[model samples]
Target: MLQHPKYIVRRLQPADAPSFYAAVRESVDELTYWMPWCSKDYSLSDAEAWMQSTSDMWAAGAEFPLGIFDATTGEVLGGTGVNHINRAYRIGNIGYWVSSKRTGQGIARFAAHESAVLGFGELGLTRLEIVVLTHNRASQRVAETVGAKLECEARNRLYFQGSPHSAFVYSLVPEDVR
Candidate 1:
């Protein structure tokens, strides 16, 4: 777990289903624009299933799904994690989303930075990548703030919702964080 003055970042748990559901519901409209999995009909069952999958992935050492929470009140702020793990290659993908109410507060960047530290220091990953839609300036800014370099742009590199979207790929190494 990573603690900050404003928020705490930690692994997802089964007990977080309700709060997670609520947060996602509140942010659904904004999230749907960038997150393929988000939609108007997202339900509590989906949140529960996602939490379960996260636990399973963690146990299998395949992915690390984390939650960002308010430090004092413990309200769910958003989600961030090092996923798409490639253990043999020592690489992982970083992804994050903040509740619309929480955007512009640097929460995504801070949580992403902490996720990178965990990826490099605890997970022994050598490289972490953050792929942002070409139109997603906010996410690109977060990547830059976390010291990820723009490596390239790939055609239809991301599969969102159902269709493929091109993205600007950014990467970071341990030295970049240090």
Candidate 2:
């Protein structure tokens, strides 16, 4: 795991599942407003399964799943990943969330910025996109902080938590990176 003063963002391990489960449990209620999946019951079993798939994807060069950790306490804060990768198009998508307690401390912004640098510089991707719920202004601000632009909105983009929701598409091209 990489250590920063405020947080650590690194590749996830199966061992982190317990903490991940606990973090999600604590944050579920607050997260459910804009993040649809947080309403469901979160168990270690599901976390383990998700970690297994994340490990496999990392092994296959198809994904990079990262867990954010608190630096001083070494607690798992939350998870994020690069998904929907298209090698031919030289593009990928960034998805992320922070634990409730850590929300306003810029952990998600640091993680997202690091991920974007990796995606563009290391992975040689030309474009990176983020799809966030329209109501998620905090996340939107993070995107803008990283220099991502507001693209088109995906109308009725997701059937989330039993309701149709629109998503704001944001993107960063290679030129947008430092």
Top TM-score model: 1
Task: TM-score each candidate.
Answer: 0.96, 0.89
Stretches of candidate 2 off by over 4 Å are 33-39
Per-candidate Cα lDDT values, in order, are 0.92, 0.83
**In candidate 1, what residue range of length 10 has the lowest lDDT sum?**
31-40
Model 1 residue runs over 4 Å out of place are: none
What is the Å distance of residue 123 in model 2 from its true position? Answer: 2.1
lDDT of 2 by residue, 1-178 (tens): 3467878888888888888888888888776765655565767787788789889999899998888888887788987768789999999998889888878888888888778877887788999998888887998999999899999889998667788889999999988877
Q: Identify the candidate with maximal lDDT.
A: 1
* CA displacement after TM-score superposition, residue 42 of candidate 2 (Å): 0.8
Error of 1 at 119 (Å): 0.6
The superposed Cα distance between candidate 1 and the true structure at residue 168, in angstroms, equals 0.5
